[model samples]
Target: MTTQMIIRLDSETKTKLTKLAQAEGKNTSQVVRELIEDYIQNRDMGSYIDDLWDRLGKKLKARNVGSREIERAIYESRASKK
Candidate 1:
C-alpha cells in the first residue's frame, strides 16, 4: 500500500536521521514514515476536538446548540463557494 518516496536532506540531517533510526532498530524509511504519519494525523484532527470544545462553549455561554445547529454550522463551513 506504500509507494516509493525520494527525499533530499542536508548531510547533517541525513546523518542524524540514520543514527536515530539505527538506535531505534529501524531504518530511515520506517522512521520517516512513522513521523510523517503521526504529523499528518495530528495536523488533520488536532483542531477537530478543539473545535468541538469551542462549539460546546458557544452552546453553553449563549444556549446549548442542538444537533441541528451543529449540522448547519458544518454545512455552512464546508459548502462549496460555487
Candidate 2:
C-alpha cells in the first residue's frame, strides 16, 4: 500500500534536493524516500558501540592479545597520570 505525504522545505533546501534528484537521475520523491529510509534505519549508539567492540575484540584475539594485558595497560596509564 502507498500513502501520500506532504512536506514543506525552505527554498534553499528544496533547490538542493532538486539538484540532487536530477544528478542521481531520480525524482525528488525517490530521493526523499531514500533519505527517510536511511534516517529510519540508522543504528542507535549502544548497538553501534557494541558492534565496534565486537570487531575490535575479534581483531585483538587474532593477534593473541588478552583482557588482562589490556587491563594492565589501562591501570598503568591511570597510575602514570596520578
Candidate 3:
C-alpha cells in the first residue's frame, strides 16, 4: 500500500526540481520517492547489515563455500570465545 505525503518547498527550489526531473525523464513524485528511499536505505543499519551479509554470501558461494562449512566455522568461532 502507498500513501501520499505533502511537503513544503520554496517556489524556486520546486521549479528547479521540476526542471531537473523533466530533464531526467521523470516526474517530481518519482524523483522525490527515489530520494526518500535512498535516504532511508542509507540511514537504516538493519538494511545495511542485511545487504552486507548478502554480498558476503554471494562471494563465499562463488568460492565454492557450502552451508556446512559456514556452520562449522561459526561453531568453531563461538567455541573459541568460551
In model 3, the Cα lDDT at residue 1 comes to 100
TM accuracy, model 1:
0.53
lDDT of 1 by residue, 1-82 (tens): 8799899999999999999899999999999899998887778776778878888788765875677877888898889653
Candidate 2 residue pairs in clash (backbone atoms < 3 Å): none
lDDT of 3 by residue, 47-68 (tens): 9999999999999999999999
lDDT of 3 at 29: 100
The deviation in Å at residue 57 for candidate 1 is: 21
lDDT of 2 at 36: 83
Ranking by TM-score: 3, 1, 2
lDDT (0-100) at residue 15 of candidate 1?
Answer: 97
Report lDDT (Cα) of residue 11, candidate 1.
100
RMSD of each: 8.0, 4.9, 1.7
Which candidate, 1 or 2, would have the higher lDDT against the true structure?
2
Model 2: which ten-residue window has the lowest total lDDT? 39-48
Name the Cα RMSD for model 2: 4.9
**Candidate 3 regions with alpha-carbon error over 4 angstroms:** 75-82
TM-score each candidate.
Answer: 0.53, 0.49, 0.84
Native-vs-model 1 lDDT?
0.85
